[model samples]
Target: MASSINHHVMERAEFDRPVKILIVTSPYYKDIADEQVVGAKAEIEAAGGTWDVAEVPGALEIPTAIGIAERMSNFDGYVALGCVIRGETTHYDTVCNDSSRAITLLGLQGLCIGNGILTVENYEQARVRAEVAEQNKGGGAAAAALHLVALARKWGGPRKGVGFKPASDEIQIAGAAKGPNLA
Candidate 1:
């Protein structure tokens, strides 16, 4: 499913420049975040795009970094990678909801922000889903980001910095890749 989605193919001049993408991860679940990082890195490099990584305290900080990156105008796209497992209290809900909303806003700014955040019920679930070496969603998210860039460039032509097509105006993602999609 994920692997099959054709991330846009552009003409030589259309993509004359390899994209610059940012992958920011949270270390709250060190092992999981590490895996996501690896998957995303491999995919980005495989596609001939340049990726730079940034470390944050926890998943809560992911949106902030994204906001910073969004304002920078340096990166053509962003991959916000993190693992937030549900705990005994409502903390998980707060983190998940808040981060999700933030990512939505970021995407609306006309910049492609691929959300690879993992919200699970337990550590085991996180471990399995964050299959950095296998189905690392980080890689999936990176692929999405790049695809969006291809779309943006096509619709508006090239620009000096990141671009976005509003959520209301954006193309349907084909499937539920933005949700609990894992393939």
Candidate 2:
């Protein structure tokens, strides 16, 4: 039944300026991570955008890395790539939920983000989703970020500090004479 489902992929985003995306990946499964990275890179390149890759120890760290990058770097968007294979322990749920929650929080703060971390029950599921020739969830994630970037560009105008006046405008007191100083 899942195979019968139809997915309608959106058209790739267009950009007037160069788009740079930072990919934060957890290489807990090195092979799977690599495949996902390849797919992400291909998608970004196809959209006339560039990307950089960052590695974290596990899925739990991916969002933290992206948050750091969002603050210290000038990337236009971010792609989160990782795999969480369900295990006997509840640690799996914590990593999956907490990482996803962190990423969502970052997005809410106006950062363009794509969440591609796969939470799968088994290695085969991760493989099918991560493989370039298969589901290519990495590419899907990149596409999601790109779409957000496009929307931000469309709806977001010049950046302004919250509750701050524009730098070009000056406030002057009425009936106050301009004088050089009496501190």
Best by lDDT: 2
6: Cα error in model 1, Å: 16
As a TM-score, model 2 comes out at: 0.88
All predictions: root-mean-square deviation over Cα?
A: 16.1, 3.1
Q: What is the lDDT of residue 3 in candidate 1?
A: 43
Model 1 lDDT, residue 178, Cα: 68
Candidate number achieving the greatest TM-score relative to the actual structure:
2
Find the number of clashing residue pairs for candidate 2. Answer: 0
With candidate 1 superimposed using the best TM-score fit, by how many Å does residue 28's alpha carbon deviate from the native?
A: 0.8
What root-mean-square deviation over C-alphas does model 2 reach?
Answer: 3.1
Residue range 17-54, candidate 2, lDDT tens digits: 98999999999999999999999999999999999999
Against the true structure, what is each candidate's TM-score? 0.75, 0.88
Where is model 1 more than 4 Å wrong at Cα? 1-14, 158-183
